[model samples]
Target: MTDITDAAKRLLLGKPMSSERLGHTLLPKRLALPIFASDALSSVAYAPDEILLTLALAGVAGTIWTPWVGLAVVLVLVVVVASYRQNVHAYPSGGGDYEVVTENLGKNAGLAVASALLVDYVLTVAVSISSASQYVASVFPALRGSEVIVAISVVVFLTFMNLRGVKESGKAFAIPVYMFMGAIGLMAMFGFFQYLTGSLGEAESAGFVLTTSEAYDQGLVGLGGALLFARAFASGCAALTGVEAISNGVPSFKRPKSRNAATTLLMLGTISASMLTVILLLAMETGVKYAENPAEQLRTVSGGAIPDDYVQHPVISQLAEVIFSGAPWLFMLVSAVTGLILMLAANTAFNGFPILGSILARDGYLPRQMHTRGDRLAFSNGIMTLATGAIVLIWVFDAQVTKLIQLYIVGVFISFTLSQLGMVRHWTGKLRKASDPRERSSMRRSRVINVIGFLLTGTVLIVVLITKFTHGAWITLLIMALLFLLMRSIRKHYDSVIEELALGDDLAAARALPSRVHAIVLVSRIHKPTMRAVSYARATRPSVLEAVTVGVDENEIATLQAEWQKMDVPVPLRVLNSPFREITRPVLSYVRSVRRQSPRDLVVVYVPEYVVGHWWEQLLHNQSAIRLKSRLLFTPGVVVSSVPWQLSSSQGHGVETTYFPQSGQPPAMEDRKR
Candidate 1:
């Protein structure tokens, strides 16, 4: 049975490769773009909506200002892209924002950036999946209530695809990503043409009059109007959420990694900015409007209320419906592509989160497992963790994109603002040392660009906090705080472990030979396992060796002694009486007594353990051995060894037990008794 299980595991995981093969999984620029830039590119789908939705709060008057707001957002996006291109070129080691801030702004600033990016990555998954669910529900009305489940399912599916390998998954993602770009681009072009020809019409919901809530009904007359516009601009800044992903993934690119990554960033910025501008322009031309609660905000000509069940499609959905009025298939195609792109947006988190986790893990800010790549050369554990967290968020929030969007862009902008500030410092430091006139000029120009980026993003961050903090950004901040604490705790633990393992002043003296070596074989019964354990212990040639057993019953104790004598065992057996049937206590007491007798000696306790054929067999045996080993581990100057007895049920069937070693060390099975 053990053989069969081992074989099954081998078949499932495949053969292990040398660590050197990890480089084979590295991605080229083409693959890296889709792998890491999907989020930023996909943001064009909903960033326009967020902008328009925020403006919709002011009624038709506010909607007219969307183009100006979009242009401002586009400018920020362009500046941010230019700033990050410099970053990718300057710090292409994949340290990204964390590295930049750490190098220039000090460690605490770097940690803050790390914490923000970590939280942002989580929100990226949650928001993208939730938005995808909304798109799915828009296309198929029957899936309305099941959005959470559908969103979670998509996250899980993307997690597996990423776990397979970055290169493989990138190939799969390229087509849909490009198709999404093409479809949206085509829609924008057609909408632009229609507007030129004076043929554009209002969306299906555009006929309904909007009843602005009391908070935003006032015209642009006072400070409140300016604040409202700031809020709208803040929401529009969601377009910049995924811009830093390329910098974080620079190392994943092939030859000239930095240049390729910079190029990819340029492409991502251009495509995303262009697409977003066109989408917003077309939405306004087509008179598309989206309301958080349509039934409440919308009224008919006769003042009749729209039904609660009325499905108000997303801005993109409504625009698609108008653009493809005659060709139903085109609308469905666009809808399908939009949903697919949103889901693929989760792939950006899939790639970035694990890589960032690995970097943090290497810095001792995360569990060590996060630093280790899997069979597919991906951070499998980190990927699964991201997927699980996303699924939980999706379920908890009921996969409502509008609700999740409020918690989105804030964390990302926090990281972006800090990162750009760090870059400004970075270029400033470089300029001081740069002797070459041309290089100094270039560095100064880069510094100016980053300074502008820092100012713009920092202002947006403040706006987001003011506008969104009370709404749901507080929850995001709470999550970031929790994650920051978690990372600090992990770092502390690793530091403590390192300190404990460090060589000390007494190292030479501690390494000196023990005055004596005392060995004992723990036996539960007079059986082959016990006999083999005794034999193995005697082979160690300790100063003293003996077999010890805890006698819980008088009859069994006498029978064991009789059988031991009758069998003429090579080692003498010593039995301890357990009045309370406490196996570990009795064994520990006897070992402590031996240690007290010879304080300078080392006590080696050999535990006779059974190798189980199945998981259930573990419960049937070795309970005392496990308890004994646990207690012995904490004892000073003591070495606990397990002498396993492989049962007939555990052997034979060509099992490969060599791959996964026990406890991250080489398997000690070779020292065990057959």
Candidate 2:
């Protein structure tokens, strides 16, 4: 079983890369762009849909504001990109927002950013994968109801690909990411060309009359109307989700890491903003209509209910269908690549989450195991942790992009606001210390950019909180708070442990030895295992030695005594009465009594255990011994050790077999009969 599992793991993850090969995993700018920017790049696919969906709540009057809201989101994206470019140049350690905020705003603020980023990374996977599943369903209508399953399967696949190693997965995903870019770019070109030539056609849904619900029957008016647009802009900000990933993943880039990372960030921002602008423009020109509840919110021009079997495809799909009306294959290609990119978009989180987790772990904010690299030189624990989180979220939300998206962007925006604020502080500090005129001028300019970024992101953060609070954004904020507290608790525990274990100046106290060692061998029967336990205990050369057992069965005890007396074993056997037949309690009581009698003396309990070859054999033995050892471990001056006796079935299963002197077989097995 172990061999098969190892083989399967190797087949899936590929052979483990040595630590020396870590340098080879560094990503070039081309690959790093896809690895770190896929999420931001792919968001153009759904950000428009979200904007239109939100505006649709106000009916047709609301949908007309899509372009303005999209432009607003793009403005924030560009500023965030510029702000983070400065972040990379200043703090190139790949700690990203956490490091910058911790350094400038103090540790508490840093932890807040860390928790926010962690939550956002998780949402990135859930929302991106769920959106991808939607695209898949659009292509193959038969798979519509199974979006949850499809999304989870894609998550597992991405996890496996990432576990293989960053460089390997980056190479594999680069093609799909570029294909998505090409497909979108081509569609945008053709879409605008057709519009310029007066040959563009209306969307299939263009003929459908969108009606206002009671909530927005008065149209975009008063406070409610203002709040509605705020909400729409907040939703469209989801496009900026992956922009910070580049800052977080700076170390993954090749030499000139900061420069390459900054360049990639600019490229990502430009591409994302352009694509979003084009998509929204084309949607408006094509008269696309998208709603949170399509069937109930949309009706035929004749005022009749739409068919129950009608499917409302996403905005990109609708745009493709109309823009490529003469070419059916282009529409399919557009849909396929959009889905492919959305799925690969999760790769950004896969790459960013682990690195951030490792950084947090290194700072004692997470489990130490998260800091360790796996066979592939990746933070495997963190990768698996992210994957598990995403799968749970996908399952809980039923893989609906609309539902999952409600919980998205809240976290990324939180990080963005704080990180930009930190950058502003960082540049201010640099300017204060700089004497060079050129350096001071550059610092002031960078500071201004970050100041603008902070104002914009902070305002958006407030709008997101106020507008999306009841719409499931509150859940994200709650989770971020809990994670903040949890990380604090973890760091406190690690700090306490460190302080308690720190070396003191008292050498004598540190090197003090126990007065004496008392050894006890636990026996279940007068068999080879018991004999081996006795022999090993005797070899320890303790001041006192004895064999102990619980009196579970009188008749068996009598028979065991008879055999012991007949063999004249050197060690004496002491049995503790267990009227209730509780092995662990009686043994624990006896060991504690021994410790109480000699406070300064050391007590060692040797347990005889079976060495099993198969997994199932583990269940048949040593359960009571395990329980007893666990109890004894907490007792002061008490030590627990296991003495293993391998059975015939335990051979050739990887564990080394040791032949004890008291065993029937010779050390070399020369005298044993086959």
Candidate 3:
């Protein structure tokens, strides 16, 4: 029997969990909708702010075009959702876009999508936590400079929840997710009712006089104006960041995985689109406006100066204040819920990056340890890596959502474009093989959707690069390139190791025993361990055998020789002098000389080792034998074995127990009894 150590037992806590238990970690459609869709859905919290801030570059009149930008983003969103529905049905292995592009296209294209999604997952954690921090700061002004700490703390909390396992985290997030949806829905409903009653009032920031930046001073009538519109559209596309998570998570769904995932995607699209559209329309109807430099762009219409100390609250806060109409409790509830939901958005990446890492590990593209699930069946290593990366980003960017926002959305669009391109190829291949007319028609329709998705996402990608690359998107691209090279090197190393370990016909010839056997027993004192070593070696029936000890002190050597003679041991005892008291070097030189004497023979060195229960016991004894064994391992054609003798302290401790019989014979007591 193999004695499992405590460390080994702890490390394998969740090994070999059944696939059926995996379903318990598997998400139902209702919980899955929020778990996977939170990223895209929560974008409504900040996407409008991005759009308005970009349009504000051209002053208030430029902001008038915000509704049109929202409309364009919605059109693109619809096309992407329809196209990915085809992707789910066609390739639902949960490799998501990475596998699809790599399989249909080539490795380079697939790697490109993988790099993009990797960067996107990082930014998702950074941006969501930062935005949530801003919401918290609005309610509690004391947390102003501590935003980075707050954001990183939230990320760490989510990481631990995810490490507990997928189903556990999903259930934890269900209530807050639903509350977010309900709060946003109620706010939108009341705002719409106020508008219908002809009693809707302007946002808190509405009456501030607008000032245009030099880039947008021309006010919507020139080349600069068109470019500003493109920039705003690109920024608004931030809402699409989490769309690909569903395709990556298809395997985590209940039975009919793809269909359930596709349905969840549709629900995600409908709810996100409706909420975003309603928010933008209400912002327009309520005369809400935003600026990157709020203090500079905003002024009192009464010719009084707006306070320099005033912090411009987020668009959600401003809108909620007006909609709730002095109902302080309702206002507080909505703000709290929104902040909580945004923090939970990090859960999307928490679930996503680990699952993708496990797939890559299985394919030899990542460290194999990532494939090992933890006590709760979660990928703990991947989760820790994700948390560390997100924390570094949050700190480096100072947890400013507006600044970090510029680096967002570029990766997701790159993946969207490539994945849609892959789907186009998939449908084309199916069309060529289909003999039935109905199947051919369906393939053709799917191809059309994918083509449109490709075009739309490609355009958005280009616009984001043009607008945001200099701001911060280039940094994200560089990070992705580094990760790509890293994963490639890891895969190469694994492949090389596998090749080195492969067996061939030469192994049999190598396994044959040498023509002769010579054994040497290493002894320090004539104790039980030393006796055990001698007995085990003699049982091997070697052609030659001797007991050797290093002579470090003359008195000790004389005492040992007397003890050996008194016992009248059958084995001849030999002692080697060590002038410098260097045990390892003398033993190594002696073993080499013996091997040279019989070059064709095998040399087996047996060193008796003491097995101690406590680690500290090792420090007090066995120094010479340990050093000798270490040197012997490097010698060619030498097999070193340890004959363990458990100490009195080691007994009843269940330490270093073994079940294998001795090399050639049973125990002396057992042989006597027989």
TM-score per candidate: 0.94, 0.96, 0.86
Give one digit per residue, the lDDT tens place, for model 2 in 13-54: 999888899999999999999899999999999999999998
- Over 1-674, each residue of candidate 1 has an lDDT whose tens digit, in order, gives 55566577456545545568767767887777777888988887788788777777777778888899999989999989998999998899999999999999987788888888888888899988888888898889899889888998898789778777777789999999988988998888788888889887788887777777677777544787787788778877878878888888888888789889888888988998898888888888777768777887788768789866678887778888998888888888898899899999989888888989999999999999999988767898889888888888888888887888888888888888999999998998888788999999999999999999999889888889998998899998998888888898999999999999887899898579899999888888887767767766766677998989899999999999999999998788999989998889989999999999999999999887877667788899898888888889999988898876676666653354322211123323433424
> How far does residue 35 in candidate 2 sit from its true spot (Å)?
0.8
List the candidate 2 regions with Cα displacement exceeding 4 Å. 215-218, 659-674
Which candidate, 2 or 3, has the higher lDDT?
A: 2
Clashes of each: 0, 0, 0
Model 3 misplaced stretches (Cα beyond 4 Å): 1-20, 302-305, 505-507, 510-674
lDDT at residue 299 of model 2 (Cα atoms): 92
Clashing pairs in 1: none
**lDDT per model, in order?**
0.84, 0.90, 0.86
Candidates ranked by lDDT, best first?
2, 3, 1
Which residue pairs clash within candidate 3?
A: none
**Strongest candidate by lDDT:** 2
- C-alpha RMSD values across all candidates: 3.0, 2.8, 4.5
Model number with the top TM-score: 2
lDDT by residue for model 3 over 1-674, one digit each (tens)?
12456456445332445556766777889989879999888999999999998898788888899999999999988889998999999888999999999999987788778878877888899999999999998888899888899999999889877876787788889899889899999999999999999878888888887787887766887878888899899999988878899999998899799999999999999999998999899998888878888777777887567887877888888888889976977888888888888999988888788878888888777789888887777888888888888999899989988888888898899899999999899888888889999989989999999999999899899999998899888988888888789888888999899888777669887677788888899888898778877777876788889998999999999999999999998889889999999788888998999889888788889888887877789899788788888889999878887887778777767734552223545445422232
Report the error of model 2 at residue 284, Å: 0.9
